[model samples]
Target chain A: MKKCSQCQNNLNYNCETCILRLSGKTLFYNVPSSLLQEIEHVDEHISINTKIYEENESNTYLYSITKGIVKLSITDASYKTRATSLLTAGMSFGLEVINKSSYLQNATSITPVKVCKIKLAREQINESKSLLENTLKKWQENITNQNQIIEKFSMGDTHTRIIRLFHYLKENSPLEEKNNFYLPRLEDISSIVNVSKENCSRALSKIKKMKEIILVDKKSKIYKT
Target chain B: MKKCSQCQNNLNYNCETCILRLSGKTLFYNVPSSLLQEIEHVDEHISINTKIYEENESNTYLYSITKGIVKLSITDASYKTRATSLLTAGMSFGLEVINKSSYLQNATSITPVKVCKIKLAREQINESKSLLENTLKKWQENITNQNQIIEKFSMGDTHTRIIRLFHYLKENSPLEEKNNFYLPRLEDISSIVNVSKENCSRALSKIKKMKEIILVDKKSKIYKT
Candidate 1:
C-alpha cells in the first residue's frame, strides 16, 4: 500500500496530494497549507447508491471528492425530490457546517466514489482569515451556480433545457476530463432538469438528432459535438 | 431636515436612524455601532423606474434600502431579462463587492425609493471579524433563497408556481407589514416567476377565485386569504 509523504499515512490520498490541496478549483485552494496540516482528514471508498449524508443531518465535516460523482438533492415539502447539483473530482460539499449545523440536502453517490472527509472545528474556522474567505467564496459560487441553473433550465422548453443542461454538464465536468464528460442516468438527468423521464428521453432524442451531444456509452458517457 | 445624532448631519435618513442599523433583518444588524460611525454614507431618494446600478458595473458601495422597493435582475446571453430578486425596506444590495468587483445583476427602483449608499472599504471588511461573519451570513441566505425560489417556482406548473410565488412574497414582505403585502405589476411578477404574462394572469385569476390571494388594487397590492 502506497503511503502519503506529508502525513506518513497508508492511504491513496493524503494531505499533500489531497484534491482540496492540489486542485485550484476547490474551496480550500487558497486555505493555507500549514492550516491544512493542522486539520484532520481521512479517505474513504464507498459503493454506488450509498447515501453519504441525509438532509438535516448534523454537519461536522467537509467532504471533498477525490474520485467519482455525487448528487446533492433536496426533498420539497410536497415530497418531490429535486437534484440541485452534481459534484465531481475536486469539488467539495458540507461547507454548510461553517454557518449551519445541519445538512440542507441529501448527498448520494451516483457512482462508486472516493472522498476525503475533513473534520472541521468552528473555532478554528472563525480564527482563520483564509478559511473564512474561501468559505465566502464557496458561498458566492453556490449562489451563482443556482442562478445559472434556474436561468438555463426554467426559462427554456424541455428540449432547450436538455441542451442547456448538457452544455452545463460539459462545462462543469472534472477539470482534466473535458472532452468525454460523465453523465448521470437519464432518470437522474430528468430530475435535475425538472422533467419527466419520458420527456427527458424525447428531448435527448431531439438533441441527439441535432448533433449537439453524442452519447458515447448510451448510459453514462457523453461527448459534446 | 432632521439631524443625525451620531454624525451631526442634517439628513432625513442618517447613520443614527439608518435601516441597516435599526432592522434585525438587515445584513448590517450585527455590525458594531462604532464601525457604523466610521463608515461614510449618503441618503439618496431615487425616482421610480430609475436604474440604481447596471450589471457588470464596478461595485463600490453597499446600497441599503431605507424605504420603497428595488428590483434586481439579470439579462441573459439571449437578451432576455429575468428578475432575480426584489429588495425592500431594511434589505441591502451591492454586497457582491465582497467577492467580486462587479455587480452580477442590475438594480432598479420599482417605486420611489430611499437608499443609504454606504461606502465599503474592502480592506476594512477583511480586517473586521463581525463584518466578515455578517457577509458570510448574507451569502448563506442568498443560497437558501435561490434554492427556495427554484424549488417553489421551477418544479411546479404555472398555477403552482404563482401560488408558491405568492406564499414566498408573503413570507418575505417587509417584517412589520406581513398581512398586507406590496406586489409588483403582473408583468414584473410574471417575469420573476418565469411565466408568460397571459399565463400569469390566467393562473392569478384561478388563484383569486380560490381565495388564495385577494388583489386589493387589482394591480399592486395583495392580501393572502
Candidate 2:
C-alpha cells in the first residue's frame, strides 16, 4: 500500500473518512485487517485523463477515486448516451464487474484523475464470503439508490422530480455547504433524470427563476437557495 | 428442519434444481458447496395455514419456498388487502426487512407451504456473506423484475402495459402449463401490474377479444392463448 510520505498513512485510499461521513459505515468495516494488509502490498495508483473504459470493454480492475471525479454512463444504439451516475474522491466504481465479466457502463474522468486500482485476479475474494460483506452491502445500497431513482421517475412530476434529485444530492453529496456541491454537466443531469437536455435546461431555468437553486460559473456549478 | 419419512428428503425451503434454474448464472456460479451446506442447516419448515409475518409487524425472517405456494399481500388501515406476489415453490420472499425494521407485506401459506426461514439473530448466515451470495443474486433479480414492472407503468400505454404484464407472468411464473399458465386471481394480477382491479378486468376483456388471452373458471383464473 502507498503510504503518505509525511504521515505514513498505510491505507489504500483517502476517501474512507469521507465515505464513512456520508454513509455512516466504512467500506472496509468487515474487511479483515490482514486482507487489507495484503491489499496494501499489491495496490497500484494510476492517473488517467478523459475516457477511461472503452465501450463494450471488460474492466479488469476495481477502482477507487483518489483525486478527481469520474462519470459513469451508458449509450444506446442511436448513439444517444446518458450519464448513469458520478463518482468522486473517496468513492469506488466498477462494482458491476462482481456479477458480470464485462462492464455494463462506461466510466470517464471529468478531470485529470488519480485512482487506486486493485486487480481482481490478485486476490481470491469470494462474493459470498463475510470478508467482503461490507463491499456487498455497499453494492446493495447502490442498487437501492438506483431503484429509488427509478421510483422517483415513475411517481413524481417533472418539477417534483427535479426537486427530488436536488434533495437527494443535498442529502448525499460529500460537500456540506449546499452551494459547494457542484452539479454535473447539463447533459449528465438530463440522462440521470431521463429528461431531454432542452427539458433539463428549461427545468433549471424555472428552478432558478423561483429562487430554489442558483447557478455559478456559467451553469457549471449549482447551489440551493 | 423437517424430513420426509419415506423419501428421506430434507425439508429445506429451496428446491436445489429450481433455485439453480431460476437464479441461473447470477447466484449459482461463484457459490461454494460448503456455503450451500451452511444454508441447508438454516432452513426451517412451516406447515400450511401458518402466518409467517403480518403486515406492519416487525420482520424477522427471510423465507424461501421449499415445497408449496405462498401468498404475499399487504393490508391497509381499513383491513382492505391486496396480494402483491404469489410466490410458488422455490421462490423467496420477506426481503422488505433489509432496509426497515418491519414488514410492509404479509405472508401466508397458500398450500402446505414448507419454508426455510432464516432467523435475523443468526450472524452465521449473513445475507451479504459469500455463502448466501447466490440468494442475494436471486433477490437482485427480483428487484430487477420489480424495476421492469415500474418501467412498464412509467413508459408503456395501458394496452401495451397489460401485454407486458402478461409476458412477464408467462416468463416468470412457476406453475406448469399444458398450453398456458393460469393466474389464479384478478387481484394478484392487478397488484403485480400496478393496475386497478377494474382496469385489470377491462384489460382482460380487451385481451380476450384480441384472442391474446382466455379466462378460465369465470374470472378466477386466466390463461394466455
Candidate 3:
C-alpha cells in the first residue's frame, strides 16, 4: 500500500460541507474522523427531468443527495429506457470511483434535485471505508428487490408485474405527490418490471380495466384517489 | 478506525490458503499488508449442483473463487429460480457479511468449485478495505449486465430475450465444454430472460426451428456443430 505520509497531516476531515450534514445519515457514519477530513465535495441543484449522467460517460465524480429525487436508468442497443432505481434525499452514489468504474446506465433527476459531488482520487479510496461498505449493502438490497419482481412475474405474465409495480409506486410514492402521482415514461416502468413498453402498456390497460388506477392526463399522471 | 494496537502485529497476511493466491488477483492488491494480516480466511470445495448458501441462510462467511463456477441466483416467492450471474475462477462474494445483510439471493455451485471463506467481523471490516471495494465493483457490473438484458428485451418479446441470453451464454462461456454445451435448467434460463418456463421452451423451439441450436438429449443440451 502506498501510504502518503503527508496526506493525513493538515487535511480537513471535518469541513462544514461534510456530506453527512445534508444526507442526515450515511454508510460511513463510523469512518474515523481523521480519515474523513481528507475528503472534499461540492453540491449543486438540478432541474426536474434533467440528465445528471449517462452510462457511457466517465465523469470521475459521484453524488450525494440533499433533496429531491434521481432516477438511475439504462438504455439497451435498441434505445429503450428502463428504470433501475430511484434515489431520494439523503442518498449518495458513485462508488464506482474505487474501481475506475465505467458506468453502464444513465442517471437523471426525476424532480428538481439537490446533490453533492465528491472527487474520488486513487489515494483517497483508502479514506472512505464507510462509503465502500455502504455500496455493498445497498447493492444487495437492490438485487433482492429486483428478484422479487422477477419472481412475482414467474408465471410468465406481464399483468402481475405491472400490478406489483403500481403497488410499489403507490407505496413508495414517486415525487412530491400526496394526490397527483405521475407515472414515469412507459419505458422506465417497463424496465423496472423486466418487460417491454408494450407489455407495460398492456399491463397498465389491464389495471385500468380493473379500475385500479385512473390515467388522468393520458400522458403520465394518475389521480391520487 | 479502531486502530487496534495488537491487531496488525501478529496477523497473518500470507498463508497457503490465501484468497489472493488462489483467485490469481483481487481488489486487495493495495490493501496494506498490516491490515491484510489481521483478517482470517479458509479454503473449501463445493460439489456440482450444491448450494453454497441461500438468501435466508446466514452462514456468516463469504467466498472467493479458486476453481470451478458458482451461480449467484434468487428464488422468488413463486418458487421460480433465476440465475443472476456466473462466478468463475477469479471472483469473490459476501459483502453482506460486513452489515449482517439480509440476502435475497442464493449462491450455488454449477460445477465443482473451490472457494475461500473469510470471516468478516466489525473490526475486520475496517481492516479489509480492499475486499469491500471489490464487492462494490462486482455488484455494479452485475447490475449493469441485468439492465442491458432488460433493455435488449424492451420490445416486449420473449423470443428475442432468449436469443440474446443464448448469445450471451455462448460468448461468456460460463462453463467448460468443447463441442456440446448443456443448457442450464430451463427455469434458471427463463429467469435470466425474465420469462416463464413455458415461454422459455417456446423460444427454444423457435431457435431450433431456425437451425441455431440442435437438441440432442432429453434434457436441454445443444450441439456446437
TM-score: which candidate is best? 1
Task: List model 2 lDDT by residue over A1-225, tens digit each.
Answer: 657433454645543333442443534445555555555323333333356685458867666665556766666433656554555565666654555546556777653455666554313455324434545455545444443444444234467667766665655444545544446567666766777788888887898799787655454454654
Question: Which ranges of candidate 1 are over 4 A from the true structure?
Answer: A1-23, A44-50, A65-70, A86-90, A110-114, A126-128, A170-178, A205-225, B1-24, B43-50, B65-71, B86-92, B109-115, B167-179, B204-225
**TM-score of every candidate relative to the true structure:** 0.78, 0.65, 0.73
Considering the two chains of model 2, state its CAPRI-style docking category. Answer: incorrect
Taking chain A of candidate 1, what TM-score results? 0.76
Query: Worst ten-residue run, lDDT, model 2 chain B?
Result: B145-154
Tens-place lDDT digits, model 3, residues B45-134 = 565567777877766787667666567776666666766666655566655665686554688875556666777565554556565555
Please, what are the lDDT tens digits per residue for candidate 1 over residues B1-225? 865433455666555566556656565666777877777776777766678889889867778777777778777656676776766677677777766568877888765677778787655566556676666666665556545655666546788777776666566554255555555567667767777789888988888798777766555454654
For candidate 2, the per-residue lDDT at A63 reads 66
Q: How many residue pairs clash per model?
A: 0, 6, 2
Per-residue CA lDDT of model 1 for A64-125, tens digit only, reads 78777787887776677777776777767777776656887788886667777878765566
Candidate 2's TM-score reads: 0.65
> Which residue runs does candidate 3 get wrong by more than 4 Å?
A1-38, A128-163, A174-179, A198-222, B1-38, B77-79, B125-136, B148-177, B202-225
